[model samples]
Target chain A: MKKNFKLVIEYDGTNYAGWQRQNNAITVQKILEEVLEKLTGRNINVIGCSRTDSGVHARGFICNFVTETTIPPSKIKYAINNLLPNDIVILDSSEVPINFHSRYNCIKKTYTYTILNREEPAAINRNYVYHFKRPLDIDLMKKGSEFLIGTHEFDSFRKIGSSVKTTTRTIYSIDIEKQEYYIKFNITGNGFLYNMVRIIVGTLLDVGVGKMTPESVKEILLAKDRSKAGMSLPAQGLCLEKIYY
Target chain B: MKKNFKLVIEYDGTNYAGWQRQNNAITVQKILEEVLEKLTGRNINVIGCSRTDSGVHARGFICNFVTETTIPPSKIKYAINNLLPNDIVILDSSEVPINFHSRYNCIKKTYTYTILNREEPAAINRNYVYHFKRPLDIDLMKKGSEFLIGTHEFDSFRKIGSSVKTTTRTIYSIDIEKQEYYIKFNITGNGFLYNMVRIIVGTLLDVGVGKMTPESVKEILLAKDRSKAGMSLPAQGLCLEKIYY
Candidate 1:
């Protein structure tokens, strides 16, 4: 009998091409599929909840796969974790409904972008954060983020190359937190378009640095022009924090 | 005229041969000296507060050097940092008294050892923490730590090959903090013998795991035998947090 398994994964995506499999580069999916094939003695197809960009990290990434192996669900995490590289870990594994889809069944997703708002860049966490030399105005950034709180057409916040049936999405919340020299933006939404979160963070950062006004965010959303939005932030600063079912 | 400068540095020591300069292996001091030489046309010698083990990290490591360069002390950090690798950063630099020394004038040092006490190891911070599979008893570790506070001979904690003038050191405090799956031991002392902090953490971990009782710490200290103490933990889990002058 075949069983479906859900895996809670955590990875340092610095060395991966992205979450998806690619021909020319290594990816988290390819590595995982190879390990799964080795463990179960069968070809595997793993479905990831988010297609995280290159150099993007994940704290609670969700994925699912069906397998004919007799290995217990609880033991799969330990077994695969031993085979996976140190940069990727299976935090938990469990038996799930056979038809449950990792991407389609997800209700909401949360992402956090960290900025090292200091003069000197950090050495230890260099790969985990973006370094911004200017002093950020947290109040202005918070006020600017208010305009992007509700459901809207986020056409201006997505990469130009991405194509979707609808560019409209619901943003649940955007929380800007400053701890010492680090600024973290916690964003949750029903869905995100390609590079949507990074562009939104960059737009808010422009407001924080007084390059753009808080009121301009609403105009940018209404304009529906990608060029009107701020530049896309680097991928390393962004992390897939959680996915709610 | 030669000017004495003090620099507060931070480094990810994964790729180096420790803080000290060596002939064959790459070291943090060697890198800094090379950068300094490029900026100023003189060979530089940097004195560090601690000879941190290979693969040990630092947050606020203090060091000093004398240079005859015309670059302002405040700008030296920026100048050298631009030439240094991303894994090492100069947090701050300033002119200091001519006779000041980083190792000799240090009053106290604070180090933190982080343990990821969970079933699986972490992927994002794999280089920054030590993963322990078994559940640790925090109260037992705390009880064992109390005996190590105050002045005592730490001969049993040092590595066997280390040649120290005296093994007696004053431990001001040892605070154990647990947040979720991470257990951090913050230790402040006037000085530390070679591998002393790692050995001490190993002893406390043994007590926490019930392999040794809390009372055994006193006996271990009294015995002053290297074999009586627990094994030395890995260097990656240890970090030099701060140095006081």
Candidate 2:
């Protein structure tokens, strides 16, 4: 009998070359497929909900695959997790409908970016956050984020050379919070273009640091030019937080 | 003119061979001294407050060194931080009296040991915490820790074959708190023997898992034999948190 297994994964992407499989680099997808092949004695094809960039982490990533192994679905997580490295963990596994596709069936996705807004750089969490030395105005950043709350053509907030069927996307929310010296941005959207979230965060950071006005973000979005947007932030600060099916 | 400078440092000890300088191993002291030598163009010796084991982290580690350089104390941190690796950071630097020393002037110290008590081990914080699969009884651990408070001879908790001037130490308090799946043991004491904190945490874990009763900790202390105590936990879970002068 053929069974479709959905897996909830958590990974520290510091050492991986992103979610996609590549011939010259180690990736999360390749590692997962190898582990599954070892466990089931067959070649495996795993589909990830998002193609997280190199050095971007994930706490609640979703993926799926089909297998004909006799191992129970409930036991698959434990078996594969033991064989995987310490940086990637299979949090949960369940049998799903055969037609289920992790990427095509995803309804919403959430991502978070963290900045260590302090004078000194962090040592313990150096690989997990972006260290920004200047003081930021949270109010201005929040005001600027409001312009990104609804549907908009996000060409200005995407990678310059990236292409997609449509540049329009719906942003459900953008919540910014600060605790002590750490600032976190939580964003939920139906879809995001290449480097979209990082570019958005960079634009908001510019607003916070008085480099750009809060209302200027509206103009930047309307311009639809990647050069008019803020600099794209580093990938280490971004994390795939959740995906709603 | 010779001036003494005190530094507050933070380090992720995942890649070093402990705090002391050794001929065959890379250590924190060696790195800091090398950085200082590069900055000041002279041989420098740094004295640390504690001799942490390999893979042990620190957030507020104190150290002191005397130098004749003309750089301001406030600028030293920024200058050295730029040259040090990302895993080590100098958080603060200030001029201290010539007679002041980081080790001799320290009056109290705080260390924290973190355990991830859950079915699945952590992926993101794999290097910073000990992943224990068994569910721990926080209440039982707290009860057992009470026997270790106040002044006592901690010979049983020290590492076997490790010699110290005195086995007597004063533990001010041991606070155990569980947030989500992480159980943190914060211990404040006047001094700690070699591997004392790790051994004490291991003994408490034994009490938490019903392997030993809370009352048995008293017997272990009274026995003053290393074999009477529980196992010494791994070094990664222990961190030097603070030093009070």
Candidate 3:
């Protein structure tokens, strides 16, 4: 029985190399595949909703895998989660259509970046959150986020080694919200280039620190060059919020 | 310059032997005291709100120490918290009256025991929570909590090797609150006999599983023998909530 299963997963990502497999490093896909193989004497490759970068967290990124084992979808989560490490959790697992690919058939994806916008270093969550001591203008950050919405040629924000050729991407929304010690940037888009979210965060941080104006974001997007954007922020602050396929 | 200082500290407790000083094992008090000796060159002793058992946690358990050094009270927290490990966070520190004590001067103490009420083993908080497979009836557990109120001689609940001569204590209240995957036993008391909270949790488990009734708690309390009480719960689920001095 070729069973197509969909899975919703959450992970810390600090210990993992990335979603993709590597020869020398531990990866999320490799861990899951090894766990499944241990369960049913056969190797099954799990496909992720997104190839999340190193140190990027996730709340509910989707995945799909085909297996010939007779195990039901309901028990798959329990079986896999039991074997997985403490940092990763499988939220929900179900049988879906055979044609429903986690990556290609996706409708939209949402990501969130968190900054511990305070003076003191993050003691407990230092690995998960980025700590910024500099005072950030919240209103200016909001304005910068406003300029990020809709279709734009985000060539300036794309990473140098991005495999994709197209730089034009449609962002559904960009929400900048802040609490006492935390600032969150929620971004929804159809697709993203390699290290796109991190570069955008770096630019927003530049805008927040008064180095650049909110209106300057438009010019940076239009420039369509990597040098036109700010440096790429670390991946620890970024979280894959969800995947809608 | 003999300064009497108070501290409200929080720790994961997974890495510590307990709050007391031991010869070889790692302890929170030992860590703080060693750091104090290194910085000030005087072998200073650190006192804690309680001798929290190994693997137990704390949120705001008070501790006090005296030093002759001229390190200002406002700066002590900065110096100590900086030296402490990542799992420990000094929330506040201030100069206190020389007459004040962390343990004896407290009005009351509050402790909470959390049971991860789920089928799957806890992944993220495996060290911080206790997992249970059996379902518990919340209303029945609430009924059992009523028996723990007021003054009682809880000899059965105390550990057999406890040095304390008196077994009589006053339990202010017992609150059983359930939310999703957690069932918390929030207990406040004038003072607790050795391992009283752990035994109480074990007895409550009996109540939740239908082996014992809520009214049976009195009979066990009056038994005044260690064998009459339920088994002692694991230390990992217990947390010293606060020392209400």
The prediction achieving the highest TM-score against the true structure is 1
Question: Lowest-scoring 10 consecutive residues by lDDT in candidate 3 chain B?
Answer: B119-128
Colliding pairs, model 2: none
- How do the residues B17-132 of candidate 3 rate in per-residue lDDT, one tens digit apiece? 98988888999898888888887899988888889888888877689988887888878878887888877877778999997889889889999999988766654456667887
Identify the superior model by lDDT, candidate 1 or candidate 3: 1
Enumerate the candidates' DockQ scores in order.
0.85, 0.77, 0.27
What would the per-residue lDDT of candidate 2 be over residues B35-80, giving only the tens digit for each residue? 9999999999999998889999999999999999999998999999
Clashes of each: 0, 0, 0
Interface RMSD of 2: 0.7
Residue A199 CA displacement from its true place in model 1, Å: 1.3
Ranking by DockQ: 1, 2, 3
For candidate 1, write residues B102-147 as lDDT tens digits: 9999999999999999888889888989999898999999999999
lDDT of 1 at B29: 96
B25: Cα error in model 3, Å: 0.8
